[model samples]
Target: MLSDPSRKYRPFPQVNLPDRQWPSRTITQAPRWLSTDLRDGNQALIDPMGAEKKQRFFDLLVKVGIKEIEVGFPSAGATEFDFISGLVRTGRVPDDVMVQVLTQSRKDLIDTSFESLRGARAAIVHLYNAVSPAWRQIVFNMTMPEIKQIAIEGAKLLRDNAAAQPDTDWHFEYSPETFSTAELDFSLEVCSAVMDILKPTPDHPIIFNLPATVEAAMPNIYADQIEYFGRNIPNRDSVIISLHTHNDRGTGVAATELGLLAGADRVEGCLFGNGERTGNVDLVTVALNMYTQGLSPGLDFSDIDEVIKTVEYCNQLPVHPRHPYAGELVFTAFSGSHQDAIKKGFAAQAQRNDELWQVPYLPIDPADLGQSYEAVIRVNSQSGKGGVAWVLEQDHGLKLPKKMQANFSSTVQELSDSTGRELTSTDIWESFEKRYHLKGDGRFRLIDFQESQSPKQQDERIFAGKIRIDGVEQSVSGRGNGLISSLANALESALGGQLDIIDYSEHAIGHGTDARAAAYVECRVGDGPVLFGVGISRDVATASVRAILSAANGA
Candidate 1:
């Protein structure tokens, strides 16, 4: 047994929101989405995105319906400042879009940020400062009043800078950077002081962005904090609340959703949650979540593959295959039960004409994101008959019967087990052709065939064929109730063996005059082991005769 490290680490205290209203709340619509891919996501990449890459990413964000984007932190470096200036000078920012630039709560940084936005049509100047007790005591060694004053001074500078830029429209935003780890009442107090300095009204409301900068607590606790702040913050009618959550606790998406229910009006994050440390909240996941619930998320990810390609190219990071909605295998089924359920679910869906998606093991239709059915049902050693039949039907247009599916699945399983690897549709089709389609030459080969009905009894039939048995050519004929039974008799007589046809089936392999008929035969010889065979020909009767001979040889 091991003792807990209580002395070294303490649990984060929960928010004291006894009357929290988030539990009864539900998200009925999409929030205003702001992407931070260029600023936060670009900074976290080992190789930061270049100017050209940033422009490409900006275009992709616009295509995906992101109206607000944090383009860069201009005061950080020349490259960042130039990137911001380039977008402004190039006329890359759309008229409906508002590009935002971030800065620290310092005079030099704020002034530099304004300088970068000098030629832009309009922009949001986001100012932030650390207000947590830990940051104040450990990093700055400042008292509560000192930290609050830093925010107020930054607000005054933003107001003065906007007053100076009369030709351009300016929107102001402020963040208590690590709001999740700060005292709730004190954080509200600092934000109120900034509001007093800015004096924002409903007509031109300022955005008060609360960030889960560290994510030191549970998602519900963060939600509780957001709800409390929304209820108690001064000038509530004159402010817009936004959330910026990080994923250090692996629950940033959950926190953001709950924060929306807690009455936040906007969200700020990056694609695939790419950011510093454990990264930011994944905006793609949040938006698509709303899409699945019948609420338009106001974003277009209908072609998610294109989004992944662009993001990976710009960030030089491979999206994990297990990432929700945008991954390579998000809609794939590998387990036996999962494959079976998916197969039956598709079948049931085909019989209906409704638009409601009810497939098992899939919350949303893969086709909605531009994925194909071939990628959904895959085959491996652990796969079942349903998976094998699904592959055959999708790839080769062969809808195998239930018993044939089980029989063929065993063959596939044996091959997969021997090689210890997954099998492709081509591999399964090849195996089937090799094992069953012995039409030309075998122990018993059918060269030609003919059929006739009795004059007195129309149901009575006769089959005749020219075949070779053990390299000897012979002619044989037999009478039975149907064509397949008559063919079985002819094959048995020609080969001098007792052929008992156990089962048989036939279907057209293609369409129109170019189509060929395929026939499957299962038979046993003198109580020996049962074997299966396949045949194809332009004539259905001829294909049946060939199938009988192949099964006789196989037995």
Candidate 2:
């Protein structure tokens, strides 16, 4: 039913190298991370961040342990210039962190950028120029030689500017802006020319950032381009390969990951993947991906909720609820089967006491990022018995037996189906109390009771109580092994019905002196169907007795 567009577009050519090495490579360590939230992410906003918000975001980046950050494009305007100048003047730029400023390949913009960075302890002067065939032919209407010369002249200007600022330590970075779509040989030529002008050594390395400016091709193509450049570019030992991927294709994270495998040494991205168009690759996801692999990403996302709040406040945009790791419902499971498996996984984890996280359906432990188990299993029409039991056990400390769980699950599912919505933990508990725990006027109700153990029959216990049936009070007595059994015997004799206990479970439901015990009982009367009931009281014995009466009333 879909229109084919094969005639309109050609497939992107694969790398010519038959022995591609990136496919077998793995990321074993953390790369140098550079956050461009203030520059790239801010620029993408409809209402760009103000000075206060920019400052707050910058501090958050530092707190997240990023040693290098592209703070702003100083030549863009007054606000950009002022934010950079303020960081320099106020000594806000930490000594250990390097603040980077973006600039075009123009001499004037490079000059203004240096002026904004003056008095800073250290900074990276990031210079970029468009170098793709499409850009060269359409935007500049120039040849490859002319475009290469522009980058060389920009490198010369950067050198002169850094020389002028003798008081600050300066590092250099260059990006072939449309490297993803640029010819491999041409991209290499331009980058090599800049490196030749910069004369960078191992101790004083230059960062050659390759940006997927528009993401014209698939992610694997970008990885091939990066690998080819890393393998062929001259003075490779003196250069640091970096990736700056965009999400136009919605595979920026995958592209960056593959690119990293292709020998890239650094990453340039924004938190939550904020950038122009489809946005940049999400650094949080990429870094945390490393964290889950047992590699220390060297970033602190322990309090991810705080991170989300700060980002949302500054960006004035709510993060998607399904966003990886940071979303409100990322750890939640609504499917019946998934919830059942997760419930069993948690139980297994508790007993195993193993340090490694192996919960079903959850890739990483939610607790590792400050999330709790309370929201892991949510109840809806689609949920099953395990999810209902998990909610009660985790949130309200009521561990229902297997049969009782099935009973409560049906109650929850019917409520959710009737309401056509999901149920919260509170909703589940409210439904449970109404259906099972509520005292009702029924066939029989227990009055005050007495229990005694006979010395002659050590195992037998005698129970006697006043019962009100059909508005009349009657004295009843029966003997059995336990309070619940004796009470059931007395009730069966008076009501003339067979009493059979199917299942039972009990647990403490609160804390301290105010704590109460909750008991669940499943029973059948004569040939009647099975019924479930619950009771709560200060004493476990009383709670069990109440559960029997509740079940009888329901029957």
Candidate 3:
């Protein structure tokens, strides 16, 4: 890497707009979206989509509520032309949806582009030419007027072709290929000349696509350029200003968003941002961002996983596991602090009465996109008590008390650290059962138990039960204020130690005929530290007695 990068590189110039209104504006609705996955996206792939893959992708885009789809550049090859022709020939194009095809500013290519969509009900014929200074001087070696004439001629060809095919509804789109680096005045002049030849009306609007072909400046500068064009363009109501931003600076999504606020009406991109270089702006991220801000993006992503699978299969590219809303790990929390906050957020959300979504570190609900809550909090060495407790409650229906969660977290932490890996819900539950003696016989076991009110004291209760101590059976009897207290007394008398019940809690594990009770006890025997015990049964009283014995055995 060069230590002095300024010696080799220069900074991009800023847009000349002092009073840009986009800064004070907010996006209130979704823009008209165009998916260029089959054109721009496939062109960038090492292994582009074949006939079957392209058809599958087309079906997916239509299912996802995209009204305009740029199917392919027909003049590129027979494969491209055949696919577009098939859609028209087979009557696959829906009445409400429009298929768009791309072409350069030439006679034969334009004719072939029209031939591909010979009988479509409606379609967009898009034309583009490079007009940036670098292209004019270095690539084409042409003057500004020569470049402007290319767009003018292409617009006329597009107009005449549509005139001949009067049966198909035709919409024309013109793009200044490298508008991101071209002079604003020259781009406007080219578009104006094209619009004059097309002679668009408010009912039949022309589309002027301004692409950040190579994202050259900050996003705000692009917004300034868009606002400038919208402010000065002729026949504003008869033209729909569109934006096609690339991610060269890793800000394509940002530029598209700001451009919308800057008065653009349409967006063009691919699913998961698949295109050349850093790829096009992600339509998924931008749409979901709008959804989070309470605006409907007019697209369906309810089954986002299915969308990811289709895109991966068609593009032969794996979507990153950390991609914004569609990634596998975007909704999972493994950090102690993050897990704790998310756990608390879910708890709070369940109690709220409103319909709005609110959760910490999560801008959107995973369930809204067909994701379950089981993966939200995973346990590793970095996890805290909240995460462990969440896993237990969600998977096993064991709501450990606050103190119990803290107590058992250390055990789990030690296991995770020693194993040096993540622990599944089953691993946590099995360890919990073993730690508290919820299953199998330990040092103490309850053989039989009975409770009755004392005749001497109306509030006092008597407990008489047979308990086994290390394989020795014995009968023990004690009296106390309640069933739990009397059990504690009986255990203390038989075990020869002072048992102090510090904390206790219980809840139903399930519902209906299969319901079972779970009881937790925090107790200290003599001078030892506090220990936790858990017991489960159909009878609440039996669960409580078993819990006392479980804790006493630990002592």
Return the top candidate by lDDT.
3
Candidate 3 lDDT by residue in tens digits, 1-555: 999999998888888899889999999989999999999999999778888679878998999999999999999999999999999999988888999999999999999999999988999999999999999999999999999999999999999999999999999999999998999999999999999899999999999999999999999999999999999899999999999999999999999999999999999999999999999999999999999999999999998866876676567576676789887688988798998998898999999998788899999999888785565322221336655676677568888887888889899888867986546666788888777777746778888989999999999999998888888888988889999888888778666777888999999999988998989999997888997888888999999888888787677
Q: On lDDT, who's better, 1 or 3?
A: 3
Q: Mind giving the per-residue lDDT tens digits that candidate 1 earns over 1-555?
A: 338688678898988888888899889989988999999999898778777678778999999899999999999899999999888988989998999999999999999999999978989999999999999999999999999999999999999998998888899999998899999999999999999999999998889999999988899998999999999998799989999999999999999999999999999999999999999999999998888888899999887866776676567576677788877677877898998998899999889899888889877888887776566422221335555565566457676766667777788878868986545556778877666645355777777767899777889898877777778888888878998777767666554677787888999988999888878878787768887777778888777777776676665
Query: How well does candidate 2 match the true structure in TM-score terms?
Result: 0.68
Off by over 4 Å in 3: 375-555
lDDT of each: 0.84, 0.85, 0.89
User: What does the lDDT read for residue 433 in candidate 1?
Assistant: 67
Predicted candidate 2 versus true structure: per-residue lDDT over 192-309, tens digit per residue: 8998888999999999999999987888888888899998988788999999999998999999999999999999999999999999999999999999999999999987765775
Q: Model 3 compared with the native: what TM-score?
A: 0.68
Candidate 3 local Cα displacement, residue 429, angstroms? 39
Q: Model 3 scores what on Cα lDDT?
A: 0.89
Off-target runs (Cα >4 Å) in candidate 2 are 375-555
Models 1 onward score TM values of 0.68, 0.68, 0.68
Ranking by TM-score: 3, 2, 1
lDDT of 3 at 319: 69
